[model samples]
Target: MIHLTLIIVDFLTGLLAAGAWALASAGGAIAALVGSGFVGFSLFRKWRRRQ
Candidate 1:
């Protein structure tokens, strides 16, 4: 019984870690996309001003 409990706990811990990792990865990708968009807009404004 103890062995089964330990296995269940280990599996739950692993699932939580994987979920956290996936969320972090998605957040990072979103941040990168937003940053790129901001930079692109800034560059476009500067180019427009010059013309």
Candidate 2:
């Protein structure tokens, strides 16, 4: 019974770790996209001004 309980605890820990990793990954991706978009917009404005 103790072994089964330990197994369940380990599984829950692993699941939580995986969920945290996925959230971090998704957040990083969103940040990168936003950063790139801002950079692109700034560059476009500069180019337009020069023209």
Candidate 3:
């Protein structure tokens, strides 16, 4: 009845929320990896020039 519907809606909302969080976490991880790669490349180039 109405209670069952409410429970279903709540469960769907929770699932959607979890999916959004996971997507955000993945995006953050990608950004961090790209940032690190850029830093490492710049440092290596600078060091190479000095040698």
Instruction: Name the 10 consecutive residues with the lowest summed lDDT in model 1.
Output: 1-10
User: Candidate 2's residue-wise lDDT over 1-51, tens digit each?
Assistant: 999999999999999999999999999999999999999999999999999
Q: Give candidate 2 misplaced runs (Cα > 4 Å).
A: none
lDDT of each: 1.00, 1.00, 1.00
Taking all chains together, the TM-score of candidate 2 against the true structure is 0.96
- How much is 39 displaced in model 3, in angstroms? 0.4
Query: Cα RMSD for candidate 3?
Result: 0.8
Off by over 4 Å in 1: none
Off by over 4 Å in 3: none
- Assess every candidate by TM-score: 0.96, 0.96, 0.90
lDDT score, candidate 1: 1.00
> Candidate 2, 4: how far from true, in Å?
0.6
Query: Predictions ranked by TM-score, top down?
Result: 2, 1, 3
